[model samples]
Structures are given as structure tokens and as C-alpha cells.
Target: MAYDEGLAQRLREALGDLPDVVEKRMFGGLACMWRGNMLVGVMGDDLIARVGPDGMADALKQPGARVFDFTGRPMKGWVVVAGEAVGEDADLADWIDRARDYVEPMPPK
Candidate 1:
């Protein structure tokens, strides 16, 4: 399936200033990576965010967020934010920031 291009563009704009950020294809979607770590991605109108293991519960509490179940098994620490949650620029930026915060301090891949 094709990913969401509009969401992908928004993510690109938000991550433009960050260092070592790369846009690549993964999960049958467009993955925005930071130093080879998955930060966020656009998949079928959903925003897939890697919020870290510790932040999983908090991230899932947010609007339109749920466990990222790309395959049969659920991926902890990753979330899928959809609908109005990612429709607003502010929310999207917040997710970006959350992703950056988690991946920014990690050791190089």
C-alpha cells in the first residue's frame, strides 16, 4: 500500500533543520530516520512514531494514538497516530519533537 504523501511532506518540513535526519522507505511506508533510527513515518494516512520504550504508555495516551501493529505482533514503543491527531500542524510538530527527543541522545547506529 502507498503511504500518505501529504503527511510525509509535513514531516520533511519539520525535520529539515535536524542533523543526520534521513528520509527512507520502510514498513511499506516513508520512514523519517535520525542517525539510522526510526523516528517517524507516514503509512496509509497514519503517522508512525517511535517514542522510545519508556514513553510508550504516555505516547499511547495521546489522541489518535495506538499500538503500532504493522505485522501480527505489536511493536512496543512505537505508535500509530491517525486522523485529527496528525491533521494539525501543532500535533504533528509535537510528535516530531517527541521522536527527536528519543532518538537525538542515542548512540550512533
Candidate 2:
């Protein structure tokens, strides 16, 4: 599936001035990596976030967020934010920040 270009642009603008950030293609989408750790991306108009294990439950409680089950089994520590969840720039930035905070401490790959 083709990823959302507008969403990707929004993410790029939101991540402006963030050091060590890079854009790459993955999971049929465009991903933003911070310090070589996967932070966030957009898949077919839905926002994908690596919220970490501890934040999974709460992250899903947010509107338009659900398990990011690319395959049959759902992956832990990640969620897909869709619809109204990413409709606002502030909300999208918050989601991206959450992923960035979780991945920033991990050793780069």
C-alpha cells in the first residue's frame, strides 16, 4: 500500500531541528529514525509509533490507536494511530515525541 505523503510531510515538519533524525522506508511506509532507533512513521494514512512496552496500554486508549499488527500476531510496544488521533499537529507531535523519548536511550543499531 502507498503511504500518506501529507502525513509524512507533517512528521518531517514536526521533527524539524531534531538532531540525528533520518528518514527511511520500512513496513511499506516512510519511517523517521532518531539516533538509529525507529521512532515513528505513517502507514496508509495511519501513524505508527514505537511507544515501548510500558506505554502500550495507555497509548492504545487514545483515540484512533490500536495494536500495530502488520502480520497475524500483534507486535508488542507499538501501536497504530489513525483517523482523528493524528488530525491535529499537536497530537501528532506528541505521539512522535513519545516514540522518540522511548528510543533515544537505546544504543544505536
Candidate 3:
């Protein structure tokens, strides 16, 4: 499955000056990593985020949030934000920031 370059680019732009940010192809989409940890990604038309267990649960309560079941097992700390949820700049940035906060402070080398 070909990933969406347009979405990938948008994610990169949102990352700004974050250090050690890298993009990798996975799960038929683009996984945006910070210090070797996956913070946010674009899977098909979905914007997936690793927002930790607590935040993950809360995020799922939102209208377009769903568990990210990439490996057949439903990952507890991950959620997929539907494309509609990220239609605006502020919404997209908020989700990315939340994911980044969860993954930051860890060694990513």
C-alpha cells in the first residue's frame, strides 16, 4: 500500500524544530518518530497517535478516535484519529503534540 506523501509532508511541517524526528514507512503509511519512539503517523487516511494508555482511553471517547490495531492485537496506548478529526490545523497540531508529549523524555538514539 502506498502511503500518502501529502499527509506525511503535513506531519513533517507540524513537527517544526523537534529534534531527532524521523519518518519511516510502515503499516501501509508513514510513521513519524521522535528519538526512535513513534509519536504520530499517517495510516491511509487515518492520523494515528501513541498517546500512552491513559490518554489513549480518553482519546477513544472522542468522536473519531479508534484503537490502532496494526498487528492484529489492539494496542492499548495507540489510537487512530480519523481524517475528519484532523481537518483543521489546530486539531492536527493538538493530536501531534499530545503524542509527542507521551514519547518525549525517552532516549531515542
Q: Candidate 3: TM-score?
A: 0.91
lDDT values for all models: 0.89, 0.90, 0.85
**Clash pairs (backbone) in predicted model 2:** none
Q: Could you give the C-alpha RMSD of every candidate to the true structure, in order shown?
A: 0.9, 1.0, 1.3
Tell me the TM-score of model 1. Answer: 0.95
- lDDT of candidate 3 over 15-103, digit per residue (tens): 97887888888888889888889889999888999999878767888768999887899988899988888888898888987897888
Alpha-carbon error at 59 in model 2, in Å? 0.2
Which candidate number maximizes lDDT? 2
| Superior candidate under TM-score, 1 versus 3 | 1
lDDT of 1 at 11: 89
Give the alpha carbon lDDT tens digit for every residue of 6-109 in model 2.
99999999998888899999999999998888899989989999999999999989989999999988989999999468989889988988898789789987
Ranking by lDDT: 2, 1, 3
Model 2 ranges off by over 4 Å: none
Error of 1 at 38 (Å): 1.0
